[model samples]
Target chain A: MDFDIKRLGFTLLGLLIVLNWGLLMSSIMRKLGARVAKRYGIRWFQPWLDLVKNYALRSQISHGIMFYLGPVFRIGGGVGLFLFMPMIIGSELWLNYSFHGDLVLLMYFQFFGMLGMALGSGEGGHPYSAIGISRGLSQFTTIEVPMTLAIISLAIQYDTLSLIDIVKAQQGGFQNWTMWTNPVATIAGMFSLLGALSHSPFNLVKAPNEIPIGPPTEYHSTFLGVLQTNAAILHVVEAALFMNLFFGGATNWFEFILKTFFIYFWSVFVGVVFPRFRIEQSVAWFLKIPLVFGVLAIILYM
Target chain B: MSETKNNNKFENPHYAKREVTGPDGKQFIVDPIKDYFSDERPKVYEPNSIPVVEKFLNWARAESLWVLGFGTGCGSIEIPPLMTPRFDAFRFGIQSRPTPRQSNVFIISGYLAVKTLKRVIRSYEQMPSPKYVLALGSCTINGGMYFDSYNTINRLDHYIPVDVYVAGCMPRPEALLAAFNRLKELIKEGKGEKANEYAANFDWYKENQKKIIKDWNMPDYNW
Candidate 1:
C-alpha cells in the first residue's frame, strides 16, 4: 500500500541494504561461532559462495507445484517482513513500506513463510521433511507464546499497534528503551528469538544428522539457493525487528549494523554454550520459563 | 524380514533369484530383482556451464563443499579429527553435512562391504549434480587390509567415479586436509565435476556395484 511510484527507488535501496547486511551478519556470526571452537572458521563471504553454488547447480527435480513454490513462499515471507518494517529512524529511504502496515500485520505475515515451507516440505514427500515440519510447528507454537505476549505487553504500554510508534516512544535516551523499562518482556522476547533463529539449543527441528535439514531435505540446487537467499535477509530483518522494538531502533546505518549484529550474537552466544534441546524439551522450557516472564511482563504492563 | 531372506539366499543358494511353489500347487519363478546396475545412458542435467561462468561456479563449488559425513567403513575415524581444533576443516568452509540433498561431496572413508556399498551407491546418487567423490584409504583404491575378504569390495572407483584418493590405511587428518586442498584445486579448475561423469557411465558403475552387492532392492536411480 505504501508503493508510491516516487518512493519505489528508496524501497529497492532499503531491500538491498537488508539483503547485503543479512548475509554479512550471518557470515560474521559464523566466523565468530568458529572462534569459540578455536577454528579459523569460513571466509567472510562463505554464505554468498554457498548461495552461488546452489544457484549454479545444473539439475533439480520437482515433487509438485508446492514443492517448487516452497522456496518461493519462504523468500516471499522474508521479503514481505523486511519491506513492511522501517529499518532506520528519521530517514525516508529506510522507512520502506511501513506506513501502510501496523505491527499486527508484521506479526501475522511471519507465518506465511512457515506455512508455505510446511506445505512445500509436505509436497516434498520425504518423511524427514514431514518430521521437520512437525518439530518446527510444534516448537513454533510454543515460541509464539512468549513472543506474542511480549508484543501485546509492548502494544499496551505504548498504546499503539505500530512498530514505528513503539520505536518513537522509546527514543530520546537509552534509559527509555524497552529493554531497560520492560526487562521482563525483553528477556521473554530474547529467549524466543533464539528459538526463532533455530540456534543450537532449539535447533531440534533441523536435527542435523537425524533428519538431514528437515524441511528442505529434497531441495537441491536453485531451490536451496532461493531458501538460503531468503534466510540471509530473514535473519537480519528478524534481528532488526527486535532492535526496533527493544533496542530503541537504529538512528543510522552504522548503528543499525552494530545494534543488530550484537542483538543476533546474543542467541549465537547461547547456541555455542548449549547443546541442542529435544523438541519436547524446548517446548516445555518455553512454556515454563519464558512464558512466565511473558505473562509477568504483561501483568506488569497492566 | 526381507533382508534376512536376501542374506539367506546369498549364503545358501548363491543366486539372486530362485524357483518357488505357489500356494495353489503351481510352480512359478520369483525374480526378486528389477532395475539393472546397467550401462544404460542415464540423463544428465546438462549444465551448459559457460567458460567464464564455469570458472566462477567451480570456485564457488570448491569453496563451499558440504561433505556427506557418511562412514561406510573404518576410515570415518580419520574424519572426526579433521573437524577438531587441530585440523579445523571449517576454516576451509568444509563441514560434514547430515544429508545428501544439501551435500556436494561424498567421502568414501574406507573398505566398502557389499552391504554398505549398496547404501553408498544409494546415497551417492541422492546428492545433487556437480558433486565430487573423495575416496579415502588404500581400501577404497585396492581394498586395503580387507582385500582378501569376500564381503568387502576390492576397488572403490569401480563402483563410483572418484575425483580424489587420499592414500593410506587411515590417512591422517593432515593428509585428509591436503587431499581436500587438492580436491578444492580440482574443483576450481573445473576438474572436480565427477557427477556428470558418473551420469555418463552410470551403467558401468552399476554393473561393477552389482557384481558384489547381490540383493538389488533399490531403484535404478536413487532419486
Candidate 2:
C-alpha cells in the first residue's frame, strides 16, 4: 500500500489548528473561572507568552534519559491520538488517518501519555512525583473502567469497531447522534470525560499549590514546555473524539469548534461547581456512579 | 564569636552515608548528598548575542513571572491577597509556582530565620538562571524588629542577590504588586541577571549562608 503524502500534510495542518484552538480554549476557561470568582483573571495571550518563556529558558537539567523521553512520549501520545482520530466527519481533508479499527488505537493512545509521564516523573525522583504518579495511575485505571465500558457499549450498538464508521452512522442530524439514541453510554462516557479532563474535582493528580504539583514537579524549561504543548493538543483531541462519538460529528470547522468547546466545557462546568476529591475518594467515585452507568449502558445496548 | 553552638553536632540521618542492599542483594554505599544530588556548580548564562532576540526573550520572561510559592516569614500573609479579587496579580502575568525548578522569581518575604535561610538558599539555588529575588518587608532589609533577635538574619542580600526591595513592616499586597512591576521593568531593561550574579558570587553567598546555617548537610548547589 502506498502512503499518501498529501493526507499527511493535511493532518499536520489539522494538528496546528487543534493545538491553537486548545490553548485558546484553556485560556478562555481560565478566564471564565476567574470571572466566576469576581477576578479579572490572566490575559488571553498569557498561555502563548508562557510557552515562549518556558522554551526560551536558558538552562535545562535531566534526571536521566527516561526523564528526557518522558515529555517526548507524552507529546507522541497526544499527536498519535490526533493522527488516528477523525476531526471533521464527512470531510476528506479532516478525516486524519482514521480507519476501520482506529477506536481501539485511540483508546490505547489516551493512556499512553500517562504511562510515559509515570516513567519520566518516576525518574525525576521527587517524592511528590512518585506520590502523584501513583495517584494519577490509580485514578486513571478506575477512569478507564467506565470509559472502556462506554466504548464497548458504543461498539456493540454500532456493530463496528471503526471510529470513521461510528461517526458515519451518527451523521444525518442531531437526533441520530448517539447522545440521543444511546443516552446511557453517552452519560457514562461524559462522566469519565470529567476524570479524563482532570479538572477541579478529579484534579488530585496535579494538586497544584497542595502537593507541590504532581508528576511534573521536577520538570522545567523545555521539558515543561513540551508537556504544556501536549496538554493543549490532548484537550482538543479528546474533546474532538467525544464530539465524533456522542455528539453529532462536525462537517465543518464552525461546528467542530462549537461542539469541541461545549464538550471541553462540560468538565470545566463540573469542576467549577464541585470541590475536589481525594485520590481514594475519586477512585471509589469512578467505580461507583460512573461504573454503574457504564454497566447500565452496556446492558441497554445488549 | 563566643563558642557558637554547633548545629552540625549530629548528622541528618537522611544525608548520612549508609549501605543499602540492591534489588539483587548486592550491597552498595548510598551517600544521599553525593549519590542523589547533582554536584555541578552553578554557571553564569549570558543573554543572546543578537540584541533583538535577547530583548524579545527578556520581554517574554518579564511578562510571565512565575513566583515560587514558598513563603518564609510573616510577610507571607501579603502574598495570598495578590491572588484575591482585590489585587489579582494574574492579570499582569504574575503567577505562583509551587516548585523552585519551575519558578524564576523568589520573594524573600519578611525576616529569615537561620533555619529557614538554609532552606531558602537551597531553593534559591535550585531555581534556574535569569532568576530574580524580590526582598519583601523591612525585616528582610535591616531585620526590622528582628534586628536584635539572634534567630533571624538582618540583611538578605548577603545570602542572595536581591533585585527589588518592597519596604514596609509587612508590605501590603499593593506594594508587592508594585515590586512585581518594578521587577518586570528591570527584567525588560535586561537588568535581571541576579541568578548569574549569585553564580559569580557563589562562594561569598555560600560562605554567608553557611555561617548562619550551622547544619549545612546538603550539597552546595541544590540542583
Candidate 3:
C-alpha cells in the first residue's frame, strides 16, 4: 500500500478545520439552549478558553496506563472516522482515503473509539466510571439496531457500499436525496442518532448523581482537553456522516455547514423539551417505535 | 518527641504505622513527618517558561472558573441565587460544574467539621491543577461560633491553601459575587497560583490535616 503525502496533509488539514469549527458549533448550540431560558450564554470562544485552562493546569494525576490511553483512543477514533470518508467529491484531492475502503469499514471504525474509551475508563478504578460505561454501552447497543437497519437499506437501495458512489447517486437534484426518497429510514436514522449523540431522554450515561460526569470522571487536565476537542469534532463528523448518507452530499463548504447543522439540531430540538428517561426506558423506547421504523424502512427498500 | 510534645507532636499508639516495600524490595515505614521533613524533594512544577503564554493562560483560567457545584456547608444555600436570573453567575464565565476533575474553584460554603474536612481535603486534592479554594463563612476562617467546638477546625488554611475568605455567618449571594470578583482579580494578576504551593508544602499541610483527622483511613494522596 503506497502512501500519498499530499492526501495525508489534506486529511490533517481537514481534521484541524473540523475540530476548530466544532467548538464554535457547540457553543452556538449552548447559546441556543441558554436563550431558551432567557439567559445570555457564554461567548463563542469560551470553550477554547476552557480547553486552554485545562491544558495549562499545574498538576495532573494518572490512574494507570490504560486510564492514560482512554482519551488517546477517543481522539484517535474521531480523527480516524473523518479521514476514512470522502469530504468532497468530483476531485481526487477531496477524496480522502475513500479508495482504501467503503462504508463497511467506516461503519466498523465507528465503534473503534467508543470501545477504546470503555476499556480505558474501566481501568480508571472509579465505580462511577464503570457504571457510566456499563449504562452507555448497553444503551449504545439498542440504538445501533435502527441505525444499522437504516444504513443497510441505503446500501441496498444504492447498490454500493462506496460512499463516493452513494453521494454521486444523489447528485443533480434535491428530491433524489435519501432523506426524501426514504423518509422512513431517515426518521429511524435520526431517532437513533439522538441516542448516539447522548441527548436528553437517552442521556442515562450522564445520570444526575449516579455518575459524576460519567466515563470522563477520572480524566483531568490535558487528558480532558484532548477528549473535549475530540468530542467537538466527533459530534460534527457524526452529523456530517448523516448529511452525506441522507441529505445530498455537499458540493461546497456552505452546503456542508447548513446540512450538518440542520441534522444536529434535529436531535437538539428533541433533547430540549423532553425529560430524561431511565436507561431501561431508553432501551425499551428504541426497541418499540424506532425499531419498528427500522424494519419498515428495510421493507420499503425491498 | 519530648521536645515537641507541647507542640502536640505525640504519635498515637492506637494506630499502626503503614509500611511499604519499595520497588527494589527495601521495606520502610511510612512516616508523614519524616517524608515531609527530608531535605530532598521530588520536582513537580513545570517551569513557567513563556511569559506571554503564561499571562494569557492566567487570564483565561481566571475567566472560566467552574466552581464545583456541591456545597460543602451552609454557604451552599447562597449558590443557587447566584445562578438565578437576579444574579446570573454564568455571565462572567463562572458556572457550576458537576465533577471535581473539571472544576477550578471549590467554595467551602461554611464551617468545616473534622468529619467533613477529611472529605473536603480529599475532594480538594482530587481537583486538577491550578485549583482555588474559597472559604465562604467566618466559621471556615476560625470556626466562628464553632471555634470552641471539638468537631470543627478553626483555621481552614492549616489543612489546605485558601485563596479567598468571604466573612459572614452565611454570606448573601451578593457577598459571594463580590468574593468571585476578588478571586477574578487575584487570578487575573496571576497571584493565586496556590496549587503548586499546596504541593510544595504537602507535608506541612498533611501534618496539620492529620493533627485533627484521627481516623485517616484514606491513602497519602486522594488521587
Question: In model 2, how large is the Cα lDDT of residue B204?
Answer: 95
Task: Sort candidate 2 into its docking category.
Answer: medium
Tens-digit lDDT track for model 2 on A10-41?
99999999999999999999999999899999
| Higher-scoring candidate on TM-score, 2 or 3 | 2
Backbone clash pairs for candidate 2 read none
Q: What TM-score against the true chain A does chain A of each candidate get? A: 0.97, 0.98, 0.96
Local error of candidate 1 at A244, Å? 1.2
User: How would the docking of model 1 be graded?
Assistant: medium
- Can you write out model 3's per-residue Cα lDDT over B77-124, one digit (the tens) per residue? 898878866777877888777788878999998988898898888788
The fnat score for candidate 1 comes to 0.86
RMSD from true fold, candidate 1? 5.2
The superposed Cα distance between candidate 1 and the true structure at residue A64, in angstroms, equals: 1.1
DockQ of each: 0.62, 0.80, 0.52
Ranking by TM-score: 2, 1, 3
Best by lDDT: 2
Interface RMSD of 3: 1.8
In order of lDDT, best first, we have 2, 1, 3
Candidate 3 runs further than 4 Å off: A207-210, B1-47
